[model samples]
Target chain A: MSFKVRQEIATCGGKLLKLSHFSELIGLSMDVNVYLPKQYYSKDYEKVIPTVYYLSGLTCSPDNASEKAFWQFQADKYGFGMVFPDTSPRGDSVPDDPEKSWDFGIAASFYVNATKKPYDKHYMMYDYIHKELPVLLDEHFSESSTKKLDFLDNVGITGHSMGGYGALTGFLKNYDANRYKSCSAFAPIVNPSSVPWGQKAFKGYLSDDENDWDKYDPCKLIKRITNTRNDMILIHQGTKDPFLKDNLKTDLLTEASKNTSWEGKIDIRYADGYDHSYFFVSTFVPDHARFHAKNLGLI
Target chain B: MSFKVRQEIATCGGKLLKLSHFSELIGLSMDVNVYLPKQYYSKDYEKVIPTVYYLSGLTCSPDNASEKAFWQFQADKYGFGMVFPDTSPRGDSVPDDPEKSWDFGIAASFYVNATKKPYDKHYMMYDYIHKELPVLLDEHFSESSTKKLDFLDNVGITGHSMGGYGALTGFLKNYDANRYKSCSAFAPIVNPSSVPWGQKAFKGYLSDDENDWDKYDPCKLIKRITNTRNDMILIHQGTKDPFLKDNLKTDLLTEASKNTSWEGKIDIRYADGYDHSYFFVSTFVPDHARFHAKNLGLI
Candidate 1:
């Protein structure tokens, strides 16, 4: 219903803005971590930099990605701004899950367009994150042709696990597919159709028709359509992930890539002994940002 | 009871062991994060590496230091093993403050010898962390050297907030203080006797006598004793931290060091716009590690 600016910390000349906003979208007061690149405070109003939005996985809020992954160093190096959105709504008339855990209720929104009754109103997370949140970020955080980022600079997308799924599907279905110069993910769940989390959330959110699942499946979408701008996708998967066998099917992605073509290429690196955690992401996020920078012509 | 390792990821040719343990010491199981340096797994059994244990402040678990602080990059670089023990015992057995939200009961144990009952039993966290945990870590992990440390080489201590107090007291009282080559912290609670957190935990766990608090207070102890070692203590504090004036009193440390006739030195840096969060620590840990590494003769 109402949004508040909780805290703002100036980091490396730029500002790290922590905002609390009531989302008609996610139906809770969401905390977003927005980074205005050093250029924003450089006094050069004409200089504009590209932007990158990072979505986090289940059971995690905006702070997890902003604080844990150490992404700012890379953002500083690459001269890009980063936006991190909380995973789900909290502290409203929202219903709590009977099982009190990190997953399922508060944090484990699968980033889907919810259709279920109690969840549908507040659970419009997909729209809020992909549509409304970005709009608000662009308006409040973005420079007014005024400085850091140009009025028309395209924004890139990247995430992990559920976020990776959101990054893929949201970018694909959104109007700004061409705006993102490059996309990447770390240990992302590829085919939700075949995973337990996917099965659970999908059954509750989507109609029972399995045919509709492919519309949201990244592996399936990649297979069905050719790229609009790039030839390949950049992905990093851990070989020893606990959820790899059941949830994240990189094999299916490999299989899908074989059939479908993109604009440039797909660079998939399978790191050994990493897991479905922030440690794995922190280890490779610099490289991922570099990957996007290269595609975006920043490097 | 039962000890189960949730995850163990190899890093820098060693392992970042995340295990949940059944504690006879704490009376309940706790999740701990341990880093066994490469020397632990090396073929040369005669080689000994000094370890630097890190303690975190309030609302932090073992994972905070291990995962969020970005210390491993430097730990590997410096060739020193790192061990992070949980701040307090978890689960229902650990009595929480009925009123307070963040500070007193669960996350904020002052790492002193607990004298209060109920809490005194499970809250002997100081000994559990500094003594018993190290022994358990040695038995389970490959780095099974309890008291054995490389005195001739480099050993150091560093922490944040309450953990900073632990590092200061721990290093000062080591059976061999000369073993520690360096000392540092980020926004540490300098004079625990003066702060609310210190007052609460100390009054609860320790006697009301103010002089007794000096044993654990770095600023107090520094004035009363002389350092045999000829190394400098590095401290990094954020200028904008809300708790800077009252909670973290580095000014007392500055005054004490000025008057103390010690051979050791203190170098404190006040970073601008940073807060008392891992975001602040992660931003500066590399420099801290590098400082230790240079002193450790690894750089």
Candidate 2:
């Protein structure tokens, strides 16, 4: 088995499998936590469980969402599994932020394939997350069994903050191919190319060229990609989020969606008196879970 | 207000208020997190909100349970507030274990009033949790207002591991006074007098004498206290808990209850494949919440 079991913890009605495997894409041993719902162990159950990939925000690892997001209950309730992937590749060999800041390097990959020197060697989060990870998970999990889990085909994607931006970018970039059956975000950095957090990451990972950024910018991707399936993207932004006014201008995505096929389908919700913490992510997780469940044909 | 608001975070249709205040009993400042449910903000609702006091395990602050317990949803659903108290009195002034072990010093108070040496002056968690904290909370929250919350009465007590022992000790010691309307625990140290973790704390905080330890031990308290109201104490023990074979030994509590008035009233449910972490506590929080809600008349 390529994936090593770090720990198998029983939570809610299922087990949380903390797995780590060497990713050829990111060139590091990537950690991921998968919550297999109660149905997986039920003798009477027959359906192959679909999965929801939850990407965490800055300074986060796979354990953060696994511990705090409270998604295991929702996954069990809907009879779906949850996959929590690490924010970025890490090790002593990997290059870090030159200034040692949180927003540019290490735990802040921006889920982009880096093109710059130093970072380009190991910071291949985009390809790791969207390409290698899912297929590998399916092969490792299903190849040995009766296809109890489907990680490649019937999948949904969602994230928080930087991860939200990742979800949007990956979803929009692969909209035509329908890589993600459902997509949503919580307090995501929508217009990363315009924001400082995104600009720093884009400039550090990619070059100063705007062309490199336009390839992954959700705002630009939203305008170019046509919604062939009439699928809607769910979003929840807290009014009291510390980053709302500055980094996460969620309204910018709404504006970018204007006059495009994705316009009016990007459902943006404003949660009053909430912050950009796990408290907010966990609170709205039910809504996002249900939305994904319906889209992934779980409901 | 004598209590300072450290932070007020919105979580799951409620606000988690992090408060810190000087504790005259313990002679140190203590931190606590209180979650005021959604019912508190409703103009249409008039019932005074009862509270559940959740004592955390060793080496945990109020923030651990406040963030990981996933109780705010249950509190909002059951129309009850939640109180997350610090495990022990902190700051450099407070005495720590001579060995600086996590099970006996700093974060680990064993929720008992110490009677020996430097520990006696500060390790007054028993009085701090059951007596002073509750009365002080009521005085601070309801002294001037229309009494929206009841901290002194109509309360439930619950905890995990070391804190579970705290809950049981607090509940049984005050059983005659009818202090808490409900009590429950998640993988609690049932017989602290015998367990190594509990014995270490007892020796450090109390004394070498077994008599002093008997006062705080649940096994002794269960036999001494009579359940006049026939109140049941709910407990969830994990079969796969690493501490089960040694420190916890939850079945001992059941054995101790054999001939006493509390016999069969201590309902212990063993969860399969669970562990000694917050993952286990959070998984069964719903069950404990329901049990407390029913006993506290929230159902």
Candidate 3:
């Protein structure tokens, strides 16, 4: 698959390349934004630049976080590249929510591989993000250079809201294989199987079996996975977030980790008076960048 | 002149107060956003907080800069409050562009008092922004407090594109009166009298008298104003900005300053690979904040 450059925007100490490519897995074109840090453009830089993938929340395209999250500055500060993948596949062939709801349709793929009819044809976001996209990026961006940009290894993952759930699930699911070196989130949905937004998405994309939903739920995965290293999952939740009460029950993840290897390793910081908006995400991005940088060995 | 609190959003150790109030000067309700830094909320804060006024470019509301410019973090870092004033008067009664174009009427007031028919009725933005807004904000916000917020004295002014022109004109025209302590611009049209955008706006708002436009034009004002304080106006112009060659001839300001008291005082820093967007503005906000902080005696 070849990546097409849509726009190259200069921001902070680097360039944000808006790219689109045809995905054989999804059978449709997908959009993703990649931010190359200042270090990559430096004359003396020789080391391979690590990447930090940011998954956005509900009803968002790649542009939302790419435009507003203020990640470019942090990426430059930490000398790390950034990858912002789209939430779902979008095209005429892509099946939308029957009811035309925002939380269940085109923008809300939940980062899960679909097993149901219609959706199964194209909604393979889990494979697209976690597997295909990384390999493709590594191949495409490293073609002309002796120094490489690491996309798979020595990479960290972070997200917000639904994408937060995606990051945690992906990180924990592939922990044994050592997939993501670091993981963090801003107001993520920790217990997705128990939340309304996740329940609707799970039912729409996955099979009717409840066991299918449990595999993708972070709360359930944390209970089973044993942390071999002294690894930590950083998370920030706003006390004033409207979804905290109903959907993003962050405490459940901590409670589920009790007596498990992740008991004290889940650092969930409760921010005061913040909400479920980019204002909240951008505020905590610097801290997340530092955490990811340390894990990726950039700091 | 009471302000209605539309929304109070917590952002980066500050609160962005979205307020709407009736403006007697413009004969319409205006929306404005004021950010109170963390210093304002500190129990030990005794010093009166200074403010920096940010004016947005064409086709913008107060929310544009409040949401995208990433200024809240800088305001908190420098311990300064921020004021984002609306560009023009708006209502059903207000006249719009005859061609329904975005550059004229409605959002495009060009920060000038209209002297022509139809627009003259409510398009008195010059008085509304520079004269009335500060007094109204001071009166309303200081009513219940012993410590005052300095909206009038010890304040800085900066803007983007058209608003950049506004900042330069305002700073130079009121230099003798000591209206603003500091001034800066991002990709500003330095010589509006010689530009097409300026010509259209000036013709539509002011009468056929070219002398009326000369008063508001920064190039003309820079030649006449005496910079006795050795004050320097900081400006950042992106080299890749599409409007640089056309509407925004930044070099004209420097040329006009030559042989005058303000020669070499107009510091225009040409940023590489940047454009005319919030991405460009947000990148340079920290620099502007520090500049203003120094001038406002906060540093």
* Top TM-score model: 2
Task: Please provide, for model 1 over A3-42, each residue's C-alpha lDDT reduced to its tens digit, 9 standing for 90 to 100.
Answer: 3668887554466778787666665677888777666666
> Per-candidate interface C-alpha RMSD?
2.9, 0.6, 1.0
Ranking by DockQ: 2, 3, 1
**Worst 10 contiguous positions by lDDT, candidate 2 chain B:** B139-148
RMSD values, in order shown: 4.3, 1.0, 1.2
Native-structure RMSD, model 1: 4.3
lDDT of each: 0.73, 0.91, 0.92
Off by over 4 Å in 3: none
Could you give candidate 2's per-residue lDDT for residues B1-299 as a string of tens digits? 87998899988988999999989998888999999999987888899899999999989999999889899999999999999999988888888887788888899998999888898998899999999998889988886456389898899999999999899999999999999999999999989889899888887778788788888989998888755687999999999999999999998998999999888888899998899888999999999999999998988
Question: Which one wins on DockQ?
Answer: 2
lDDT (C-alpha) at residue B66 in model 3: 87
Fnat of each candidate: 0.33, 0.93, 0.51
TM-score of each: 0.84, 0.99, 0.98
